[model samples]
Target chain A: MRTILSVLLGVIAVTTAPPALAALNVFACEPEWGALVTELGGDKVSVYVATTGRQDPHQIQARPSLIAQARKADLTVCTGAELEIGWMPMVERSAANARIQPGAPGAFEAASHVRLLEIPARLDRAEGDIHASGNPHIQTDPRNILTVAKPLSDKLAELDPANAAYYDNRHADFVHRWTQALQRWQAEAAPLKGVPVAVQHKSWVYFFDWTGLREIVALEPKPGIPPSSGYLAQVLEQVRREPVKMVIRAAYEDPRPSEFLSEQAKIPAVELPFTVGGTDGAGDLFSLYDDTLHRLLEALGHDSSKP
Target chain B: MNTTRFVIAACAAIGALSCPGTGFAASDQELKEIQQQIQALKSEYEEKIKSLEARLEAAEQAARAAEAKAAAAQTGVAAATPPPAPPPPAQPVAPAAAGAFNPAISAVLLGTFGQFSRNPDKARIPGFELGPDAGAGERGFSLNESEVDLAANIDQALYGSLVIALQPDNTVNVEEGYLQTTSLPWGFTVKAGRFFSGIGYLNEQHIHAWDFVDAPLPYRALLNTQYGDDGGQVRWLAPTDWFLEFGGEAFRGDAFPAANGPGHGKGAGSLFVHSGGDIGESSSWLAGLSYLQTRAGDRVTGADVFSGRDHIGIASLVYKWAPQGNPTQRNLILTGEFFHGLEEGTFDGNRFDQWRDGWYLQGVYQFMPRWRIGFRHDELDSDRLAGVFAGGTLDNLGHVPRRNTALLEFDTSEFARFRLQYTRDDADLTTDDEVLLTYNVTYGPHGAHRF
Candidate 1:
């Protein structure tokens, strides 16, 4: 019993010991939020991302590693609106960290900063997985990123007051560069305006809204449901009548459905990096949009090098 | 041109009339004088108009130069300085409706159809006493322990959950009801109220979350399927990159394995430690060690009664693998547990002391989306009893009981599943072959799946 007690005490001492560096620890639920925090916080914050860009944010399991990371976090950044309703709550409950609880200064939810799209008028299970708080895929729109950056930077400053000016300056730099990038993209993607397209999932509402693209048909019969062959056939029939320019899907989505639609319609199939680090070209927030626009332009037979 | 000619003739006539009744030659001379005078006057006025136009042009040029200078200064300022940083907009989105703070309530419905090669009513594991919750389903169609769960954040600092099980026999059981600290500092949490003890790895997991249709043989025999009691628990998680947790529980001892009539004073206690970490991006593992100590006073099961002190030790390991750390498509899970129990004191008025052991290994593989196949093997052995304790529940009967089970499962979505399971058992008095078809569905708020 004495040995057991001594060992436990040793573990407590080791675990509770403060680190040499006084950086604020941030736990980001998804890779996009992680990249955004890094862009704003720079060297003042240490970040742990719970899921990769290739993983579905909505379907992540509450892995133990996530809980361990959350236990040490000073702030938690996530896209709320129930996108992570399945697991983030469990991680927060198990972490036992007072600093990152909901309604605390250290908790930053990006969805609250901007108007969300596609709030369900009616709630029903038969409609497939739906978020009552609206579509949580707000990161698809670059304008929403700008909107979230201010509050997230404020949150960082709130948590680590010593680095407040640093975060503020970084946030200003990001906004300047992001605004210029948005302008350049608008000019480069002029030909894509009002282009008709097909999508495998409804995750690209914000993306379509940003680029002025028209959604012709979705391969999935409903949100979050994998497409059935019969449903795909109906979509193909619709595409035959409408003749969309291409079929688009996120980098993380399964390719089979969109590939089939592309084959049947004889249109180009475009895979876009939906978030930061989703593809090799999408190494940061800027390149994420750059690569996405590049793929969409390339599908339209425009020389990507010119843009 | 005509109008100009008419105006010149009219001016000449007017000049002629001014010299009334004069000669034609005299009129011509007078017109010449008048024209000369008009020419001189026109020249003076034209010169003045020219001077005036020059002054006006100078003023316009000066105004244009000043405007050009101002425009250049504005462009220069814009180039030299960046725009001022804009403040984050006030939340343009109205916060989502502050709906009533209602708990997330969900229900799981489980229905099963069972077929047995032998009479399930006569089922009994040799040398073991089964709890009321043990054994497989009786014959044909039956509703399993369907559950209704309610969970919510009580406040900023506390969380609470309740789960009630509805048995097919029209009995309602409180499977779990607990309040837990959410804002505790230093990776510590406190839980109070009736709860499943945090001993073995699988004990705390609800039945609806179980990977299989039923518990393993060791769990059934040693833990009475699952052990829950009125208790308070404290768990401390290590602040490390690796997942490490230590927890202990003190129970009121009115539940299974503890039997009845312990008269309070913490009739049972358990301590457990678990550690886990990821291996690269494709795999992760968790391992744990747990110990439980309790007293059983006049515990009775099917004419076999005992009064004794019980001690149980368990070691469990679970490893999961997915391609690129994504489990949506294909994945594999390998899990196993070892249990050892020691009992002392009197059994049916005989001095009884014995130690027994059991273990099981299970693996489930998801070959494709929504499809899975799994297999498990369970075995138990004991120290043989003799003399007065012979033929009793503790008697080994010179047999090492074992069982093997296989199952195939399909998930239509995250909220629904269908499974077909088959088992060959020798743990009971007579070897039995069991086959079961079950469907499980959950609706309302989705539940979290813990790894």
Candidate 2:
């Protein structure tokens, strides 16, 4: 009888304890932002990522879990150049969290910090799912990540002022490490300058600008349209004349188009980790860039171990 | 000798004084000409400086006017077109400030060519009466109903969505129009307006998203195609690891099954609970239970009126499997729902109680990225009433109804689909076979459907 009473008292103590309030809840729309939030917030925040590495960020199905997470978030981060236009608005409306509403201090967008590429000179639906704001795949280049980190950390501090010092220190440390990594990458990737390549989509324009890899042609007929047989033939003809070394594609994209081009043009198809967790080695922001360079260098028949 | 020397000195002194006076006159004239040239150069430079200052002032005024015009144009664009919020610190496209009210508009066109083994005039259930608009379309080349949808955020705390369906006979129906609260506290949302009831799984989905060309036998018999009425609803989502939801609705109950009366007060109400979660890396499942109850005052079916209480209960389960978490390439879905209803009422001056039940099971498999095949089976059972009822059609009372359907569909793109379906319906003594080929296309911005 005494033991039973003791067990009952123990259960009451466990159930009545208050939940940890020090941890801020964060909702990230993609895996890259999720990794960034974790890197900065550490144990001071709990994060929920809405999409996996394999899923396309352009469209997502409406789920109750997403709404539930959004409702509880203190800060919501996303690549907001219309990348999530298909469902983000609806999710925001459903979650009804005033803190994470547009224009709120808790709402952060990474694309706003970086200089967006591929701004269409004209707007037309015939362009095939073109974003009016610009290209939203900004996480491919590490330089853009460094640019976004400063503002995102400030946003976190604004939302949770108690953790301002923590965010500031972490952001400063990240910037320092990131600058050194950028220098190392530039030195190692000197050989890739002026190397002509073909891409499956326009997602790699920023990455190309960083590495000095020349994009000779694209496999996609338009922005999002798959190439027709006639279009593929034209690309093949262009590739034969220009003689590109490799065909590049994101790991999430279908490999069939790249493979078809590779077979016809007799070039290698190299799949790059477009964001964090895109490949096995790309577990964080640092490894994401490391793996991307390693694959690109390996495709060029150069030893990545030396770099 | 002294007198001659003095005369020579005086002549030499006069010659020296006259020569000095002539040189001074020549130097004074040259100095006056040089002073005139210097005055002309100073006046020219002063005139140039005055004109340059006027040009500079004009250019500055023009620049200020241009800036103001650009600001007005920015506001005009914001008011005219509902632009999405601009990213921070970028002045390229000024994000709509507070008044961005652009609503998403979409339209869906559904067309079908159906071939029936027999005349559609004989398509009737034994002991059931069809509604006014329940008949299938005319034999060949008939236009099906098309839908136009408009949705927008009403304000910071509310959202509005409307769908209007255009019928083949040049009539328009407001299928659904509702305003729902978005930012309710404690995971609660309230919706007010006309909407489909939160009944079984497939009831809330539009026909364009249906697996088959038409609703199953159970849905048609129990809910008259789909149960929608002017109503108010409240839904709550649980804060849990898995997906859990509870909802309740109060409707006017003016549509079929319920009598047309003053649609105020608690005419009809329903309660439902649903839960779903992933089973493993590649599989997921959802299950739900719902209950609805209403009082029918002078409800007319065929010729008789049912005045009493009606209750319905539904249970549904769905399981989906996709290999390696990629549903685009291949997936399989198995879903089923069972409905049971009880009606106690006075039929043609005679008191009668009846019980009815129906169920359907369907499975769809996508063999490839863009191709899929599906099969569905429906079965229904009803309790036969004894004694003759006045002004009613109850000829074959004890027959069980069933149907079998098979479909093959191809999705050309995300916005276009083509399907061919064959159904063997055995609702009457004489079975009917229907073969329908359908094409569905969507235009504009369409939101992603619920999973």
- Considering just the first chain, candidate 1 attains a TM-score of 0.95
Once fitted onto the true fold, the runs of candidate 1 whose alpha carbons sit more than 4 angstroms away are A1-22, A305-307, B1-99, B264-266
Model 1 agreement with the true structure over B1-451: per-residue lDDT tens digits: 5435545755676757776656534456767776776676667668989999999999999999998997788777747643332223534554453345678899999999999998888777777778877786678999998999999999999999999999999999888999999998889999999999888778889877888888998889888899889989999988887788989998888776886735634388999999887898889898999999988788887876777778999999999998778787788999999999997878778887788899999999999777999999999988989888788777778988899999999988889989999999888767899999999999989789788
Q: Report the CAPRI category for model 1.
A: acceptable
Docking class of 2: acceptable
Estimate the TM-score for candidate 2: 0.82
Which residue pairs clash in candidate 2? none
> What are the per-residue Cα lDDT tens digits for candidate 1 across A131-214?
987889999988888889988998888878888999999999998888888777766766888999999888989877777899
For model 1, name the residue pairs that clash.
none
Q: What tens digits encode model 2's per-residue C-alpha lDDT throughout B4-29?
A: 44344333444444676665333555
| Model 2, span A14-41: residue lDDT tens | 6434356546889999999999988888
TM-score of chain B of 1: 0.79
User: Which ten-residue region of model 1 chain B has the weakest summed lDDT?
Assistant: B82-91
Off by over 4 Å in 2: A1-22, A121-125, A227-231, A304-307, B1-92, B95-100, B132-138, B261-266, B389-396
Interface RMSD of predicted model 1: 3.9
Query: Could you list the chain B TM-scores for each candidate?
Result: 0.79, 0.76
